[model samples]
Target: MENKFRRIMRTEIHKGKRVHLFHDRLVTPTGKEVEWELIMHPGASAVIPIDEDGKIVMVRQYRNASDDYVLEIPAGVFDKPDEDPLVCAKRELEEEIGYTSEDVTFLYKFYSSIGICDEVIHIFVAKNLVLSEQNLDDDEFVTIERYTLDELVDMIFDGRLSDNKTISAIMTYKVSLERA
Candidate 1:
C-alpha cells in the first residue's frame, strides 16, 4: 500500500555516448539500507521502419562493447531533451539507415532498465520508407537491411536479433497489427 524504496543518494560515475554510470543508495521496505549501483542511460528512440511493401528496415553494425556485428533497428540519442520522441525517431532513421517516412507512428515507450537506473526507450513504426543519402555521425557505423515481417519474426526466434529495443519494437508492432 505504500512505496517501499526510497532513494538516499545518486552520484554519477561515468558518462558515455549512450550510457552513464551511477552510484546510488536506497532504503528497502524492510527498513534496510542498500547500495544500488548500475549504468544510467539517457534513453533512446528506436525505429522499426517498414517500406511500402511491408518489409522491415534494420541496421547491421559492429558493436564495440559486444565485439560482434548485431542486427538492430535504427536508433539514436536525443540531441535536444525537449524534442519530441517522434522527431528523434525520424532523425535516427535517416541518419542511421538513410531512409525517411511520412507515416511514422509511435509504437510504445518503456523502460530499458528500471531497477537501478532511470532509462526509458521510445519505439516507433515508420511506414512508407523512402531512400535518401545517409547522414551518419562521424563515429556512427551501420548498414541497412530489409526483411519481411515474417522473416523478422523468425530472426527473433532464432536469436539472430539480440538488441532489446529492436526485439521489443518488432514484437509490439506485430501485436498492435493483430489488435487492429
Candidate 2:
C-alpha cells in the first residue's frame, strides 16, 4: 500500500529549535479542501539499554510540555535531518545512561503524535553494554534508574511509567524476549 494523501500546499507558520509548524492545505478523500496544522520534527531515536544484570535503563527528566518529571527510555533527536536513527540511538545510550553497546538492534518505530506531528521515533534495544561516563548536554538534567523487565511491566499497568514511547518500547522488548 502507498500513501494517497496529497498536500496541496504547506504554509510555514514558525520554525523553532525543535519543530517547524505549518498549515497544510489538502484535498480529502471526499474531495473537500481542508487546512490542517502540522508539526514537522527532525525525528528522534530511543534505546532500551538492558545492562549485564538484566536491568533496563531509564531516564527521569522534566518535560516542559507536560510540566512534569517523567520516566522514559533514553532518547534524543537527530543532530541533523539526514542522521541515521541507529547512530542517534547509539549515541543516546552512551550520553544519557553512561553506557555503550556493540550489539544494538532496531526494535520498532512510531510517530510520537500521529495526528499533529511528524516526529517518527526509531526505537532500539542495546545489549552487552559497556559502562561509560555519561555525557549530558548542557541543558539536559536526567537521572538514571534501572529496573527489571517485569517490574517495568508492573509500572506500566500500575500507571507509574506514562511515557508512550517508553511503554511501547518496554512491551516490544518483552514480546521480543518471549519470541527468543
Point to the candidate with the largest lDDT.
2
lDDT of 1 by residue, 57-130 (tens): 78998888789989999988787555688889999989988888889888889988677666778998888888
Shift of residue 143 alpha carbon in model 2, Å: 1.0
Once fitted onto the true fold, the runs of candidate 1 whose alpha carbons sit more than 4 angstroms away are: none
Off by over 4 Å in 2: 1-4
Who wins the TM-score comparison?
Answer: 2
| Model 2 TM-score relative to the real fold | 0.95
For candidate 2, the 10 contiguous residues with the lowest summed lDDT are 1-10
Model 2 C-alpha lDDT per residue in residues 61-175, reported as the tens digit of each score: 9999789999999999999888999999999998999999989999989999999999999999999999899999998899989999999999999999999999999998899
Worst 10 residues of 1 by lDDT: 76-85
What does the lDDT read for residue 103 in candidate 1?
90
Backbone-clash count (model 2):
0
Cα deviation of 89, candidate 2, in Å: 0.7
Report residue 62 deviation for candidate 1 (angstroms).
Answer: 1.1
